[model samples]
Structure formats: structure tokens, C-alpha cells
Target: MSASTHIAVVGLGYVGLPLAMALAEHYPTIGYDLNEKRIRALRQHQDHTQEVTAEQLKNSALELTNNCQDLVRANVYIMTVPTPVDSNHTPDLSPLLTASEAIGGLLKQGDVVIYESTVYPGATEGICADTLEQASGLKLNQDFYLGYSPERINPGDKVNTLQTIVKVVAGSTSETADFINGIYQKIIPAGTHIAPSIEVAEAAKAIENTQRDINIAFMNELSMMFHEMNIDVLDVIAAASTKWNFLPFKPGLVGGHCIGVDPYYLIHQSQQHGYFPQLITTARRLNENMSSYVSERILKLMALHSKHIVKSRILILGVTFKENCPDLRNTRVVEIKDQLERYHARVDICDPWADSTDLKQEYGIELTQNPRADSYDLVILAVAHDCFKEDAYTPQNFSREDGLVFDLKGLLPKNEVNARL
Candidate 1:
């Protein structure tokens, strides 16, 4: 079955690009994204995301395209579209639905449409299934089949990659499930686990991030409690990590495509079924307010140093959502900058990994490449990128004499920084 199968990975961003590259090693595969510029860049071995290197892109046989008609030849269509939240943090399924609607028109008998996008339970079986069926004029399970294999792609993570992570797959029918599992097995050396139903697979993906969000929320709560007691949260975390069975989750701004947004999908789905999850709701609220919390903490530190808030010079080191990555989706650092700016503080953000155009367009804030030494009233190390490592660079050098420096990620030398979260 694998030898004759042709694969088309739709929405080729971070997830689809890697998956298509891996699948191309074993099967005939083409990657399609709507962005023509991105397609042109990928074809020339230039990936702005930096998830895949120039050498890897240049060597891979994965065909890249922006035209939808190019996807009609593949028997397997994997949806790696982004499933983000709106301004209100509600699940935005427009990207998912639009991709599904497009793929449905090209569906043929015995074709399998597998979703790699993260969504709430029953989303693939209910919403996406209906969309495909309506557009294709075919009955699911009787004509075309559906599958769900949630993508486990970690942006900027090189160690636990696509082939290393275990894949969870499910299908509308038993034979379909087995077929999907086998196909993923060839690409994933860590192997695949076949779920009993599509809903179970979808729900598994939702909670994987929700669990991390709740755990990090607990850590954030601890950071707040320890702050009130005049204790450092990183010191406390270091001590607690010595235990045999402790889960080592640090406290900081939780943002990105998965942890920041996946929980809301489950929360929205649960509410539809008349079940309001208290723990999940509280965690989401607390994580969302971390920006305000960090902003207030910085202001308090500035006040203690006899510095006024208005027209104060501030430098924010690293603005990307996470360290060592250019992905800026739902970054909480912007919120921190906004909260501080409301008090008339001038905040200059510098991130080597992020694009200057994207940072300015997303937040209307310009990116500073080379910050002058000892020129700022205060400095905040928000993202722990490799360039700003304590061994490589000094964040204190950016702060003026007697100025305060706060290490949000606990990456700086403890003695150099005044406080840490």
C-alpha cells in the first residue's frame, strides 16, 4: 500500500514542510502552501522559518507549490493548517475549514484525508467530516475516508523531531486506521499508536498542551506566591527538581502556537457539552495575565531604584514567542511591552531570530539590532535565545549604571540580574 501511495501535505508551514520532507524520503510527496513567496523561497533552499536548513531543503526531493490543482494527484492529503484563536481567545477554525473545503473538491474514491492540525475532540469526525462530505458529494466511510494524526512538531526543536516523536493515528474505519498507522510508521521511527476512534485521537492532541499549560500555570502561581515572600522562583524550582518524580516545568511567559492556544479549543468544546472546567479555565486566565504581572513587577523594581515611569528607557531582549525560533504567533512579550508602554515607558525590542518586518507589522514596534552599551534605564530578558546567553552576551551591559535588570527566563547569571521569574 505504501509503495503505490502518493502524498500531498497541505498548508506547508513549519509542520507540513518537515512532514513532507520526511514522507518524500519514502513516497512521492508534494507540499502545497498558499503563500507564493514562501514557495519560491523554499524552492531555492531558503526557509525563513529556519526549521529546515538550507542544506536540507536543497537536498530534499519534496515538491513545493502554491497552486491547489497540484494536490489533485495525491491519494493522501495531510492537513497541517494552523488552528489558532481569535482576539477573544476562541478557537478560529477558518483556516482548518477552508483547507478542508479545498481538499474535498479534489477527493477521489478510496482517498484518505488525514488532519494533522490540533483541534477539540470530535472536530475531525464532525466538522471536518461534514465539510469534506458536502464538498465532495461522497459519504464518509462508504466512499472517501477520514483520518486524524495530530502533528507533534515543536518549532525550533531539533532533538525530538518529526521522526523521533511517536505519532497517534485514528481513522473512520478499522482498515483505514491500520493503513494510516502503517504509513506514518515508515516516516516515524519512534512509531505510531492507533487510537480506537478519531475523537480519541483529537482529544489526545488537545490535552497534551492543556496539561503543559496547567502545569506551567501552577509554576507561574508558585512564582507569584514566592515573589510575595521575597524568594526567587528559579531557586525554588532548582531545589524541587532534585526530587525523584517531580515534573520540571519552569515559570515564564507561555506562548506559541500550541501551549497558548490549544487549551481554549478544549475549553470551548467542553462548554458546548454543558461542562465548565474550573482548573483549565483558571489556568488559562492566569497564564493570559502573566504579561500584566511581569509589567507590574518591572515597574515596582524601577520605582525602587528611584526611576520615574514616564519617558524611561527600557530594552526588551528577545521578542519571539520562544527561544531560538522565528515563530511569533501569540507571543506574550508583546503584551508585556504594551503594558509597560501604557505608562509612557519607551521599550525597544531586539530579537536576532525574528524578522524586523514581521515584528513591526505585528506590534507596530520597531526592532533594534545593536543596542548601545549602558544606554537604558532597565533591561528585561524575556526570551532566552542563544545569542543572549550569559556566557556569550551581557544583558547588564545594556542597562545604565545603577539600572536594574530582570531575567524573565532565569538564563542570566544570578548575581548580575536583580530578580528572576
Candidate 2:
């Protein structure tokens, strides 16, 4: 492994931004994104995503560029682009492939192309490696090298960061694997786990999220069952968690770049290999319909409160996928809103973390800048953003005195909520 390495991080979103900044400390790093606006904001030391702070951007030596030509100087390219699912819930690798093809065009004989995106096993060598070969006319492990270092970025989490999380590195060849390990070991203080092979690396990443999805799905199904029995699922979880072997997985909408989507990638690949993957596939379906379940439960609460669904005012606290993060890739909160709207209810979204512009653009959702006090007939705390958990922002302040207060995140007091899932 050479000390003088130029690393180019492709697709500077939540994962790419922090990784690029961290890599800059040890190597000459450049962060590239196709979005011109993102590059402009980053250059101004204003990270709209809030992944990187202003001071960090100001102090970091990472080069930010949207131009493909600027990546020509780099010998190591890391693909950090998203691998979201299509409308039909199929794995859409267009973003990953597009970034791969672009980086492939600039590949040199000894240059390495590392993928940090979450994908099914063998995607790097079987799909992306093929793309690199087609574009650059480079032979894998001979002319150019390939590495798989699946990203372990947890958005909105102050803990378990790039430096803290144990990184998994793998490559097409053993030598290339060691080189990739050395590159990541520079910044990852928690150290690295060198996987035996790239397929294992990819499978490791897929399982990381798929396992979470399965556990969460179990919790979600249990919540639904407990709800029908008129027993609070959280209370059940609390009692169960007293045991040493119990897994404390909470029930909620499973949507994001990883947990909600990554399992589908595994499911897709599993199906392609002639295995149905019944358990994982069932878990995905159950999790995907949680928004609908939550919405139906909210409407049931409204009916109990004598509030008519038609033309009713409903306020949703938090629009982003998760709390304290604005990276709304496949948030199911919008599905809840849409389901309510179908019944002619007027839904108002309020999230301090999400950008109003992004809300309107990405999902055609308009953020209620000023939610009227005690005006809504129903209030749903869809996302437990830290600010929403405060005393000042409680249900009594937003919903009508007798309005239904549905707490999906179990953040509000049991007495304060009409129902919690």
C-alpha cells in the first residue's frame, strides 16, 4: 500500500460527506456529487444535510467537486452512492452503476475502486466490477483492483461514528484486501475487520441491516398483536427486556437508506439464485405495511374521539425518515399522510429537522411553519425528533383538548397519548 494516495469519494450524501472528511486527514481526498447545489453548499462551509458541521468543513482539507474531471487526479475511488429500490420495490442500482461508470472512465492501471454502498452479495464483482471493466477496459485484479468496504454510517447518531465503528474491508485479491485495510485503519480508531473475501464483505453488510429489519419486523408484528389485545407493546417489551436474552427491538416505520431498503437487495439476490428467502421476504412485507397499520390505528383513534375523518385537521410531528436527521430516502411517514388524505383529512406536517424546501420537492409535502395551538383534531408524533420529546411540544399544546394523540414512537407519556404503537 502506498502512503501517497489520492482518494475520491463518489456521491457526497450522508455517508460520503463524513467519510470524505475523515479520509482527508490521512490522504488527499476529494468528495464528488452530481448535485451542483450540494457542492456549492459544501464549498460555502454550509452542510444542509447537517452531517458535517461548519467548523469541521472549514478545518478539513477535503476537496469538494461536482465535476467528473476533478476526480482524474485520484488513484483510489470509493463509491458511496445510494442503492435505493424502485417504485416496484426492486433494487435500483442505477445510481451505484452510474457512479461506477463515471469513476471507471478515470481508472488507471493500478488505481483501486472501492465500494461503500449497501448492496447484495457479489454486486461489486458481478455487477459494478463488470461496469468498471466495460468503461475503462481494465481487468480486475490485473489492471485495476476492486475493494468492498460496506458503509456503516448511522445517520442522526452522535455515537457509533466512522472512527468508532469497526470497519469491514475486503477486496478481489488478498494483496488488494490488505491495501484497503491499511487505507481505512488510518482513520478508524475502533480498528478494522478484514473479511476473507469481498462477497463476505457484501453479505456482512446486507445481513447487518436485514437482521435488524427482521428483528424490528418481529417487534412490529408483536405490537399489532398486542394492540388488538388492548395491551401496550412497550410495557410488554419492558417486562421482556428484564431477561438477559431478550432483544429490545421497538416497533416503528422501517424506512431509510439501509434497514428498510437493504433487505430487499438481499431478497432480490436470493430470489435470483432460486431461493425465495421466505423469512426475510415476509419481514420486509410486514415492515412495509406498518405505515398503513399506523394510519388505520390513527383513524380508529379519531373515531373513538368522535372526530370525523373527512375534512379533519391532523398534525404530524416530524417528516424526515428518522429523528434528528434530514436524510429522507424512503420514509414511510409520507405514506401515513397519504393514507389519511385519501379519507379527505387535511394533514399538516411539522418537522424542525427537515428542510421545508426538500419536503415540498421530494415528497410534495409542505411543512407547517406555524402549527396552530390546540387546533388539530388529531396529532400524530410520527418521528420522535428530540425537540418533539420536550415538554413544551407535548400533545396537549398542538391537538384539541379532546383530540386523538397517536404516539407512534412511544415518546409521549401513556396518559398523554390516545394510543401508541
Candidate 3:
């Protein structure tokens, strides 16, 4: 049988919003989120994540709702919630569990629930399924079914949209698998890859980001080594690019929902299966320390400029993890601010993309939306956001007469900037 006509997409953030918008082209889709404020904003064609443009939201036939009762009509429910870590760095499955419970309460017989949240293997079968069964009194693979379609949504990435990227879908049963693939194939122009089972699909999804994380971690380590040798990492990468086999992953702070966080899911699963992934764990550690490393280097740069490291005014150019995107989840840029504050350095953060209230609430770091130019002793481009990179070309007055300039992403030419990581 083909997929159902009604679909419900839970957690309307970066991932779900785009998917829901695309699916709405073919089905009567309900874009649901618990946040009423967000739903209201979406109804008025405002996307807080900025993934969906106003025109797209207004033109789409999708219904945005905050009520769980409103989703009872959807036969296909997709969960696309954020899977962040706790303060101790352990995976926090609370968001996933909460979303599952919300769906479970509205789940009807014969309904199929799919998950796009990144999790360790068995999460769909174990935690989510259990919640569904308890909430709806439905038996998995009997009264209802479950599927796993890992989200490839790159927040702030304009090139890879829902239709552009190939989606990986797997179901609890063969019939369900085909049905899910058929629905996705209609919208995702890149098509779908049906895995052998849901577990394989989950494993495949986790590794996609894990592999990138490991690759970037290698580049990050190389950046540290090159910095010690007084070599520009980006220049070395440019030289290496002449070789066909050389990977083009550059070194910078590995943040965002996927690269910085998804590896832990693989780590958790690997450990559960009685195997420790040494290389993956080591790469994660290396990437995690890069923010602090950048902070230390900037302090040393201040010392070289005949300025005292302590009690110096330093301005952080970008707070968002990636360039041109406002997403701040698991952002390592905060580490630089925290480290600078420890040394009694006045750290002023300015990111045109970041929401000042959210930054203040999450990191306890107040943001200056527009700090005056060239008013500080040091300026560190922690994030290579397009706004900051553009700011590099136009000189600022925030820095002292002979200020220390540290370009973390090597965004500017060698002669234009002082140092790079």
C-alpha cells in the first residue's frame, strides 16, 4: 500500500520545518511544536530558525499547530526534535522522549511514526516504542509501526534542502519500509535509500556526521600542530588541495547539532556493544578543546603586541557556530568567551545572527548586537560566519592602534590579518 495522505511533523525547528514544508506539497501536513509562540510565528509566516523563508511559509499549505489534539488526524507522524547533551556532556534524550510521548498520546491504530532525531541505535525500538505503547496501548509492529529516517538538514545550509539530499528510510517491517520510501521518493528529488532494517538506518545516519566529525577533528589537530610550527593551516591545506585524493575539510570550531554532538551517539552505541571507538573518542576530545585553544592563542597574541593578557578588552566577532547561520546549539564559541573571562579579560560578543536573549539565557553571556569597531585590544574571529568575514574586509575601530588580530578560520589574506589557526 502507498503512504497516507495526512502527515504530522513534530518539533518544527531546523529539521522538521523544511521537511514539513516540502511534504505539504503532496499531503495535508500538520507542522506541530509544543511552543505556542513558535506556532503563532509560523502561522504568520515567520520562521525563527530562518530555514524557511516567509514566502515559502506563506505559500505552503501546511498547517502549523501547537496542540497535540490537532495531530490526531495525521496517520504518519515524524519526530524531528533536538538531541542535545547535558551539562556533564552525556546525551540528553529528554527531548526525544518528550516528543515520543506527545505523539504516543495522539497515535491511532495503524499509524506509523518515524524519527529524524539523532540517537544511538535501538532508541526508536526501545525508548520511543515503549513510550508509544504505554501512551496509546498499541503493540509495536502489530497495532502500529515505527520507522527511522535520519535527518540530513544542515542548519544555515542553503544548498542542501529537503529535496536535494538523499534521505535514508527504514521501517519495522518490509511493507512499512516500502510505504515510507514511496512517500519520501515523491518529494525528495534525490530519492531514498532503504536500509535492511531500522537499526541499520540508524547506524548509517549516526556515522554520516561522525565521519565528518572525525575528519574535521583531524584538521583541527593539524591546525594546532601547524600553529606551533608557525605555519598557516589554510595555506598548507591549499597546497595539499593540488592532490586529487586530499580531503578538503578545513579546521575550525566543530559545533552545531551534528558534527559536535552526533559522534557521542556512536560512542554510546559502540560502548554498549562491548567496543570502545578509540579514534572517534579521541577526535571528539580534540575538537572539544579547540575553542579553549583558540582563546589561549589569542591571549598569547596580546602578550606579543605588548599588551597585558589580563584585564585586556577583547571582542569576539562571531558567536554562532557556523558561518551565516544563527544556530547556536552546542556552539563551542562560548568556550572562548568563558576562557577569556577567567583571565579577567573583558570579552564583548557581537553576532548579527545570534539572538541576544537566547545567548544570555543559555551561556549567561550578554551579547552586544553592534559593538563599536576598533575599540578593543584584541579581536578574535571565533566563528567564520559570513557577517564576520565581511566585517574583516571593512576595518573596525574597536581594536587598539596596534591590536592583536587572530583569525580563527583564516578567512582573510595573510597580509590583511595578523595570525590564523
Candidate 4:
């Protein structure tokens, strides 16, 4: 917790970057990543992720590095690398393993290695510890300690930041847990909750997103059923809200790093333990299919309006996963575009928050930050980025007269929008 302690944060993305920046306020931090571009940008005080601003980066005491040898300067190592899935939706552990090996090379006696990425219950101890032991030639629990502090970073949220949100910390041992909790307590003004063990912290993190995914999946199913019955899902939800205890979860495309993918990690781990994760898997499937369903609904709405379907030029407003953010790792908005393309519709995407290269690399689709509003026959507001709602970005000079405007996430006025999901 002291400024004398040099900390190493591996994989400087959404979760790790913010954490490193926060820790840098009191500790000399090393922000390490394998990506040279990210390291270069960080050194230049230009974070493309936008989680940390240029001025904030300039003020930070965090040193950016790519080489594993550079991490030897720090004793407290925290891993925040990705835990993405394979094309088959299976948990891919390659990134985690590679990070563990990298950190292990710089391991010193009495150093603590903490994991912040979402994983199965025993992943921190089983996979990472084993890799560390093999790579560093250090015995577990004796030579070095392990800890888990699962990240709870909501991408677009400005209110619940690293300093404000309560951090959950746990460790391989009680002493380790206290040390880890003390470190996080320095920056986390909302305080910390020390779990019983590292596995409990892992389980706690996975369940947080899993619960949200299931709630949204139920709403998505209700949305589909209500659509068939010619009832607006939002309207029904509003009516249902008259009851005191009604949960007001809305229906939309479930995407991004946490909600769209974390449940699968739990499901895979559960299955590995000889138990099927029924409700969790069911919710994942239902939420995963929402993009295609949304695309079809758009087509049906076009047909209902007697608008041209195949050759019509469609403009998608936002491409990022969530509103007001730029992190586009596993956005499901691309799925809607894919489904629409199958119907022979020429869809032009525009997201002020997303980078064109990320959109192309992740989904094989091109996104224009400056879209020609005149050519769009239909404008589908997929993500409610703050720019889209502003008068300057609304493009009043364009086809507001001759096009159908479909607000999918209900970010705009109901009277102005033609339809909503």
C-alpha cells in the first residue's frame, strides 16, 4: 500500500489500465502488456482505450513495458489479461497461461501474484500456480503467494470507478488476503470485501455477470413473445412496473466482455466438475441469439412499412457494445449487421466511439465515424452512444423525412422514433 512498493499490472486493457493508473497514485506501478502498440501509446500518454485520459496518463507514475524482464522491478504482480472463448464458445486459457508464464519468469520469493480476470473457481490456483511453479522453479505457498481480486469494471460507467466501487479481494492464505486487501484499500474509497478464499472471489465475480445475463435473457424471451402477441415489450414492462417488487430489466443485444462471455466460463467449469449448468447455459443461448432476432425484427418492420428490403441502404447508428463507451471486444451489434447482410441489405455502420480497424478485425465489418445520412433508407440506433443523442451528431440535415428511424435501446424520444425494441 505504500509508495515504496513497486506494483506490476499485466495486460493493460480496460480492467488493468484503470487499476494501474489508480495504484500509481500511491505506488510506482509497471503497466505491462505484450502489445507494443499499446505500450507505445501508454508511454506517449495516448490511451486508445479512453478509460484513462491523456492528462491522467501524463500525471500517472505507471511505467509502460512489454518485456517480462521489466517486471522484475515490481514485487506485487496483478494479472488482468483477457479470458475470451474459442469460436465454439469454449473457454480459451491460452492468454491466461501465457501471462502466468511471463509473470513467473520475474517471480521473486515472497512476491504476491494476483489475478483480476474472470475465471473458473480454481483457475488462479490450479492453472496459474502450476505454470508459475514450472516457469520460476518456485514452490507454491512457500516461495510465493497468490491472490484473486476479480475486476468489476463496467465499460461505459463513469460513476462507479476504480476509486468508488467496492473491490472484492481474496488470497491463497489469510495473510495473503490481508496484504491484498490492504493494497486495494488504499485507492478503493468504497472499501473492500475480503472473501474466504481465492476460489470464492472467482465464483463471486462470475455470478455477478451471470445473474445479469439471466435476468436480461428472461427479458429478451419476454420481448420475443410479446412481439408475437403484438404488444410492445417496453410498454408491458412499464405496466408490470406498477407492482412494487417488479424487476425492470430491459431487453437488448447482450454483448461486451462480461455479460456475453463470462457465463460460459462458469458453465464450462461446472460441466468439468460433472454438473451441467442448465439455467446459466440456457440464458447464454437466449441472450446470444438476440442480435439475429433484432435483425429479423427490423426486416419485418421494414416490410410492415412497405419500404424496400433487399436493395435498401441501412444505416446503423452505433457499433460499440454499450452506449457511451469505446471498448469493442465482443460486441453483438456486428451480429445484427451479419444477419441483415444475409438479406442482401447494404448496411453502413457509424459509431463515434469505435475504431474502424477494431470493427473490421473483430467482426469483418467496416464502421464509418462519419456516415452519409442522406443515403440511408433506414437508420437503426443500435447503441446509444452519447454523441448520437447530441444535436450536433443527430444529423438533422439528412434523411429524417424519407427514412425509418428505429431506436433499439430506447435512448431517444418515443415520438421522434418510428419504432423501438
User: What's the TM-score of every candidate structure?
Assistant: 0.98, 0.98, 0.96, 0.95
TM-score (C-alpha) between model 2 and the true structure: 0.98
**Ten consecutive residues with minimal summed lDDT in candidate 3?**
388-397
Alpha-carbon local distance difference test for all models:
0.91, 0.90, 0.85, 0.87
Candidate 3 residue-wise lDDT, 261-349, digit = tens: 88898898789889999999999999988888887788777777678878888888888888888888878888888888899998888
lDDT of 1 by residue, 1-421 (tens): 2337999999888899999999999989999999998899999999888888999998998988999999999999999999999999899999999999999999988899999999999899898999999999988988888899999989999998999999999999998999899889999999899999999999999999999999999999999999999998888888999999999899999999999999999999999999999999999999999999999999888888799989998899999999999998889999988888899999888888889988888878789988888889889999999888753356877888878899999887799798888
lDDT of 3 at 410: 76
In order of TM-score, best first, we have: 2, 1, 3, 4
Point out the higher-scoring one by lDDT: 3 or 4: 4
Tens-place lDDT per residue, model 2, 1-421, is 3457999999898899999999999899999999999999999999987878999999999999999999999999999998989988899999989888888899988999999999899899998999999999989988999999999999988887888999999988999999999999999999999999999999999999999999999999999999899999999999999999999999999988899999889988989999999999899999999999988888778778778999999999987888888877788999999999999999999888889898889999888987989898989998988898776677668988778788889998899788889
Q: Residues 319-388, candidate 4, lDDT per residue (tens digit)?
A: 8889889888788888888788888988888888888887788778777766664767788888878787
lDDT of 2 at 8: 93
Give candidate 4's whole-model lDDT.
0.87
Clash number for candidate 4? 0
lDDT of 2 at 347: 92
| Regions more than 4 Å wrong, model 3 | 1-4, 389-397
Query: Model 3 Cα displacement at 112 (Å)?
Result: 0.5
User: Which residue pairs clash within candidate 2?
Assistant: none
Say which prediction, candidate 3 or candidate 4, comes out ahead on TM-score: 3
